[model samples]
Target: MVRALLSRARDMLDGIPHRWGSAAIASSSASGHGAEDAVAGYVRMLGAGVRPDAYTFPSLLKAVARGAAAAAEVGGAVHAHVVKFGMESSAHAASSLIVMYAAMGDAAAARALLEACPGATGGAPPPVMWNALISGHNRSGRFDLSCRSFADMVRAGAMATPVTYVSVISACGKGKDLLLGMQVHKRVVGCGMFPDLRVGNALVDMYAECGDMDAALVLFEGMLVRSMASWTSVISGLVRSGQVDRARELFDHMPERDTVAWTVMIDGYVRVGRFREALETFRRMQFCKARADEFTMVSVITACAQLGAQETGEWARIYMGRVGIKMDIFVGNVLIDMYSKCGSIERALDVFGDMHNKDKFTWTAIILGLAVNGRGKEAIDMFYRMLKASLIPDEVTFIGVLTACTHTGLVDKGREFFLCMTEVYNISPTVVHYGCLIDVLGRAGKLKEALHTIDEMPMRPNSTIWGTLLAACRVHGNSVIGELAAERLLELDPDNSTAYILLSNMYAKSNRWKDVQRIRQVIMEKGIKKEPGCSMIEMNGIIHEFLAADRSHPMSKEIYSKLETVLIDLWNAGYVPDVTEVFVEVTEEEKQKVLYWHSEKLAIAFALLTSESNVTIRIVKNLRMCLDCHNAIKLISKLYGRKVIVRDRTRFHHFRHGSCSCKDYW
Candidate 1:
């Protein structure tokens, strides 16, 4: 019965085209399920004296590409059979060898096969053979050779197809060779392949990756037949180039949305802190019944974290479980961030502990979550565990560890980690790395050391680095560093309004009325205006965006009335306005008015009027929460008996029962 069944199966398979049979085998191998079994079956077929032909080679080559441990042996047997059949010099067999070796990540073998193929020594190889070789080099990460191969093929008068241009465009993106990519674009147009969607999509992606949005847009507009990939590449390119509005427009016009499209748009909106749009798009995706893949889930989790959506985040966690997708390291990391941002450090720890295979990203996410949550000691402990697990610390990992130290006023520990990051890991500090250390020292009131750090940096200090020092000056009330830091910040960012605002605020705090007026004169002269700080809070699945003191909402009256009640209670509890934070040439009454309309306060008021009494209120801010807002929110949490989670530009602030996760550092 088994013999009869085998015969019948073979007969059925024989009735299919060889290309179809090859595709089936390749798909199975690519899926990683059929590697060893396929190899053994191929060996058994050989033992049965089945005469394998060219059609059989792609399947065997596919198995070799799958990187099974026995690839070399299986491929060698196939090569030997080709030689025995006197087909070694055949273009078909040689191309197969090149593809097989490339898949094996053995670029050397692929090159040898190309050189030895008939007519390859002097005359041009067939385009098929050239494509196979170039593709192999590309997959093997030998982009230089891939590009060289494409050029050589074209120079030899081989016809360039859309696939050829796509491959070359991909190589250009990898090498960041913008000039060469432009040459490829010219050649693509010269060859009358200008409107090919695949080529157009590849060109758009290449340009986008190189930060050339204009070029990408030009190609995108010229394409006649746009597929989902074409739309996504352009949309994502726009987002990456900071043309968020254009990206959103394109997204709204896409005929159909795929998981990539949904995830990319959500990621763009979340990156710019447009939480309401991110959540609404996510809802639209759900309504369209698009299954959230892991990437999509990760993007949405990040958005939720930014908005401090504890209930929504937990609901997403349950939804992920229902979808039967196992939580991988990326998903686990995002979950940790979400829970920590939602004021549930215990849940963050649970996700960290349950992760099956934790990578550096996984470690960094959990550690950063703990650090941002003000559990600095636990974050430091986790760093040690990561070292014990033999995961080398990268620049980002140290940032988390050092930030934890900064938050807890662990000056000594922060210094040790900073030194060890350079000495032990041999990882040179970047500008960002220096910025973190400056923040650490400045936060500890080590103004002198922070100044020294600024001087010692190899690269010119950016406005952000100087801004850190200035911020520390504000906290420590150090006039000297504040002046010098402000000068440095202005020099670095001449048009930056934030630095001027900070400087003016420092001058006002010191009662320097002349300096404040002078700063205001400069701001007026330069026509520089401060962007109003705004915060958004999501309530009942609708996002409520508020500008500082905004009274434009439908429930503005009630929100302001609630704000008045909170302000009365906060004042009775000894809350005083940090009048200097207004940082402008305004009357005291005007300054207080400005403070009252600050975005976070407005968001808080809105949350109070609209949300359930005991429910946690989540707010997201575009910048760091100001001192007054932070202090006021703490009091409001206690007065209202509510938890308020706020996500600022850099990290999360979980305020509950009058305490914050950052323990006031953030």
Candidate 2:
């Protein structure tokens, strides 16, 4: 089959115009043939006496470079043939070798070919060849080589154009080399390469990636020619560098936003957990008739999951069905994530089951949803099923299984999966992986094990791992580990009020009143303030935000009054203020009164008062719910017979029938 295809390709190549012969070669080589078969077929062409010329090397090398498992080995043979044919010195042949080697991930060989070709001038490689080489290096994580090669192009007096500059700048982005990137920016201006859209886009991307939004905006504003890519690069960069407000401004200002621009803005909102804005932008994208690609679908699905927008997510599913998009691994994974987060794990399982093809990410997504959403036993079973199907679990898959173990308090199962990740899969644990493990141990009241896990981590622990331990300490009443975790968290992020609050709670829980007072004193001395917890719920397409003790709503008086009634009812039902959280010089009654206005409780009451009877209330919170608030939500869910979904900073809480979706673990 391969020889026949190659023979047909060679016969067709003979009839193509000389200028289009290279394209024809690339086209034929990319026709889904195996590299080994392509190689065998090419040799057969030579044996049949089809006198291979300069064009032949380009075609044959391309086939071998991308076709077979042994891409580089086969590519080297093609190079030898070119050299033997006395075409090695030809500029076309040399350029093809340069690109072929680079594409085959052998940059050294590409450089050697460039050095050996006498016909190769300083810029003889051409921009196409240079772009290929630089992009290849970037893909291979050889940022230094890419940067050095760009410099060599300039020092050798090669005319470096904007296309080439984009490749070089992107390479710097891969390296995260801010200083080197800035130096490249200087070279761009000094070499009179400004005003080029591609170069300007690269500059915007570089600065945004390096956390220099000021420079990124400056470049964006000064660009004489800005394409959609130029605008999207800056907008997306701002979003990624934690400047979401600036990103929104640019997104709103774009006179014409393509699908990429809209998707990126939605992604920015999703990243910051602002799903309402993401949904709004998605609606606007549809209004503008911009096409929703796979990425747009993913972002919208993520927003639906966070907001529990069943109607919107179902609409997306219907749209995807109508369009007949392939639902490839990424789309499938996100769909599963959406269904899982939206309190529809059955839908998540259905999507998972319907997938004709599955990759590691797909498995991980479904497993994670089940594990974290009160299906710990099912998560474990599905993981075993994955192994039965001979699918290997990567590090990400382990996190899901570990989360399942944590939620179910399956200490032994968690340890087994943790070992499987390192021993069976040979996958080294990342900080996220460690964080999940620590959470599992901490939740199980294995404080010693959680602490030991942090100490045994190969790399220095990040705030996330320590934060997990701190949260677990709160649950398990381990003051020592809680204090240690808080201290470490403060060292990593000094202004993190969550750490300070958690430490204060730890002290108060252990009856260390002086310590709690000292913590408040320290907070005052440092001029740091705890950001009030806020939750938002969407009703009739309008979002309402509620803060702790917030009285800013138009119906504030009514809302507060209704909240007081709920507090009175809960108080009669044996609810008590977990007074440790008050952290104020106030009377006991004042503290109890203050607890009634807690963000989640207020939001729940407001949602109940506004929405129709029996409607579910979905609220997104910026911080964790306190113990008292969690219990109150449980009782409210049952009393009102409403399903309340609150997505706090750490995880989701689904309250109904006097129970939570987290199974009382979170």
Candidate 3:
């Protein structure tokens, strides 16, 4: 249809009588790729002596802007002809030149054109010309200049039109200028443009993006009419302010929802760590038959990655393909991350290999994915490959590199990467980098070196840093430094349950019964509840969750019976239960029983009973794998000859043939 319209427009232009005032050459909106032909036809008409009028230059300039790199030269040529024709003083012609210059990002030329105006009409060259100036700058992301131009327009005794207010307010919103936005709001109201739908929406957006959610909500509520943009702006703003629940409430109340609206809610849930809710929202979107776009897919994929719900994520990927959503760079990057986090490293590699265009983020995602999946050497190799591809590593890329070295016991290599991050890349080391370095040193039993590194840090250590040191101390059984680390951690977070649990577990493993009892009593008195351990398995797009000794599944009877038989067979095969992992005051037999009913065991049992004999078993657990479960699963993998992948809080553990990919380090 667009081609037919362009053809018809050309035929009309060719029929012109080629005389002064015989016809005005006006092209339709010609401002996208390949409209240069229309501009050339207009030039032909001009040479044929169809004298141009005020309205002719605007269309000609609009048409010329479609010429790609040649637009600037053609626009200048057209401007010279407009001068020869004495249409330079026409407000339409001058504003068209401004628009043309602005489209070229020639801000100085655009300003020069604007300055040459106003003297012709005597006061700011009319509001339409000023509107063109401000809107051009706003479109160019020069929000500062847009606001300044709007202020100058007002000072020049020119009243802004609705178009002017909308562009300026949008500028204020995107520029994050709340004060100027409020002043613009007052002007909008004073000029009686507040009720205009476009102006009102711009005001709401201004308030929202400036982080004034209260004002945004109030203004939104008071609007007599609301569009999807109004609702989307407020909801996304609420999400930005960490009021995700309120944003969801407003989202629920929206009269209709589009893909962007649904995507904002899903992304909000993901940002707040509500992964289950995020996935559930995606399900609801599908149920409502709402269209999902790439943004929607990215949010859903991210939710699946966080939850380790590989099956659901795969469904999303397939759905995108069925729905004709292109596998662009963003979708590909996130897919690699999703598969990697879900312990599907082969799938991650496949996605990485399949991507035709790779950016810094694409390489970063795969590098981090490999690091977390216990493939440190491959991650390092990927990093060098990324550099070979001419991609400079960012802060996130370095984090993955440091993690790879830490897990692989390459302390010296980790230190080298850390130094390179500063000296070579000119990237300053953050606390996260420092913590990774400490973990590298601590895991290698260089406890004193880790402490000295901490002391030499440029900034104060946060709880995460202290916690990392304390964890290392527990691993090496250094009670004295462990005590100091624990004290520092406790001072940072008075009622931190993880710190208390780690200290108590360390004491229990060392047979310091008194210290364990003391920490346990303190935890009880403080009413600090430990995070209950849980594990999840995703099969056929349904996530099944299990807690310790859970009996809620329909297959509970068979699962428990299978687990019992499996444990017995492993025990007979020389699997001794590591009761030292039972971090509680219980009898020896009770601790062994408790270890048998752990959440991961139940998940494993369920997986075994429901899956095919040759199928790999994957589990995602919230907490770190305990010694008893880790040792038991290793033996289970070897005996059953099933590759089992478990993603715990810290990293991945790939168990096969009675050995772990972490090599017993993590």
Candidate 4:
């Protein structure tokens, strides 16, 4: 029966005139399997000697516009045919050809066609023709030209339609020109063309992209009709504005949700450092049977990276393969980052090796992963390898390389790369780069050079640079430089409780009790509360959080009991509590008690108690690990013959056999 229908279709095609065949091609291009297939059928009709007409070229051009990469050569061929038939002057054919050339990424050809329109001399082309030109430029990413064409159209007395405003407003958003966007919005309102679904949605996106969320929200609420695109735009804008809770509310109220909406929400959560919530929303998306795409998976993987949810991250990577999702560069890079952040550097390397294509981001992720995992030499080698491949290093690439140098105490290499960045690569060092260099000098105990580097910085140092220097001072017991760094940091960020606390601790270490008391009083006067220390551990796809002296966990008793046992072994291994690192005015015993209940210690205790022996224990801490806890963990690892990996606020520490990867430098 299918063969009979096919035969009849061919018979009809053989008898149809060129005009009828053109109409059939248009119909097929709009509703058939795809434009390429329809175009192929049209070519078959040509092979059967059906004479091409003026109507025939437009349909062929339309097919070229619909077909993406495969249509470029076909479009050129059609343009040649139009020239041969003298049909290029036909307004419809010219406009269709312009759109086709633009869709094929040939902006030059599209412009030439626009200029060749029949009304090109004194009068402007038709509005439809101008709209095609504007849209073509927009598609080619020449937004500036797109906006210029809009002005040209207006000056030529061409009537702008809702479609024109939509394209122009989108260009405004891309260029981040809120002023021009508002001008366009005014025009839209003045023409009584406001509130068109497409136009209104573009306006919302423009306002949102320009950081005017209030205006976006107002417009969104006033719109009588909203599409899924509108909701997604507003939701993403709200997320970018740091209103995650409001974004979530809107997302929950969305009448319909698509894959893009789900991905936006998940990405929003990840952006705000709410990884667990991101994962929860992802699970809900799966429960609702919303098919996850590449974007959704990238967001989910990023959330796992931040949370150090290695098990779930690995499962996501495996699931991508099982579901036949192509491991594109984006997914591949994030996977490397996820495994690296989860302390699985080997797995990160594996992913890196498996990627078929590697961009700068791909190299940067793996380099940073190796750097953070304390494989600094390997990171440096990878940077050279990237250079050998003729890939120019960007700012982020330098950051990873500088960080690797700092981690490995390669001071000379760090200096060379620092100079090479500005002198050879011509990449101006951002404050972050300076911070990394400061950390390198500070770690190497070159306190004077670190301070000098700050003085010689081309730009004013930020709070992070000063804070990094102060941290190094605290680490090396250089109270003089520590005092200077603290003062500068406080001046820059007056309400920074970490600076106050660190300054007070430095003073206490030298028995300068009065100075310590003054800082504490200042903290109280300013109401600057210190951020509570927190530590987290992931087990069996669940993350457990603990705070200093926390007893909220269901297994608190067992955790505390295990902590006590570990303390005994640590003491037996000759571990001494570094009371000087504690800033409290209490007695030494009380100081020891305070130190024992640190959040990371509690997390480690819980992990040791619950997990099987011989497995590496991983802990993530929100604050820098205390000296006493660091020493205790080192001893505990030696005593129990276990390896403990801790990711503190600044860097990673792998403790084994009474030694730390940081070599007591951090």
Candidate 4 residue-wise lDDT at 335 = 96
Q: Write the per-residue lDDT of candidate 2 for residues 18-76, one digit (tens) a residue.
A: 33333433443433344445555665676577767877776666555554223544455
Model 4 misses residue 57 by how many Å?
12
> Against the unseen true structure, what C-alpha lDDT does each candidate score?
0.78, 0.77, 0.84, 0.84
lDDT of 4 by residue, 1-666 (tens): 323422433444433345444544554443323565656676686779876777888877776676554445455556656665677678777788887777667776666656545564555567788889888777767788789889988997889999899889998987888999999999999999866999999999999988899999999999999999999999999999999999999999999999999999999999999999999999999899888988999999999888888888988988888887767678999999998887889999999998766778989999999998899999999999998877789999999999999999899899899999999999999999999999889988899999999999999999999999998887787899999999999999988877987787778767788887787667667777657889999887889999989999999999999999988887777888876455455677898988899899999999888888777888888888888888888887888888998988878898999899888877
Better of 1 and 3 by lDDT: 3
lDDT of 3 by residue, 179-296 (tens): 9999989878887765888999898889999999889989998999999999999999999999999999999999999999999999999999999999999999999999999899
Q: Candidate 2, which segments miss by more than 4 Å at Cα?
A: 1-224, 240-255, 271-275, 306-311, 319-326, 386-394, 430-432, 451-530, 555-558, 564-580, 612-614, 661-665
List the RMSD of every prediction in angstroms. 8.0, 8.0, 7.9, 8.4
Q: Is candidate 1 or candidate 2 better by TM-score?
A: 1
TM-score of each: 0.76, 0.69, 0.82, 0.82
lDDT of 1 by residue, 1-666 (tens): 323422433444432334333544453443344454565566567657787777776776666666533355445545555555566656677787787776666666666666555564456566777788777777767788889989888787788778888888888877778899999888888878767778888898889878888888887787778899888988887887888899999998999998899999988998887866787888989999987887888888888877777667887888889997656667888999888776678999898888756778889988887887678899999999999988898999999998888778898899899999999999898898889889889999999999998898999999899998997887777878899999888887888887887787777768887987888888878888777687877777566788876778998888888888889999999999876556555788898878877899988888888778877787878887877888888888887899988888777788877877766654
TM-score of 3: 0.82
Candidate 4 structure, TM-score to reference? 0.82
Residue 248 of model 4 has an lDDT of: 99
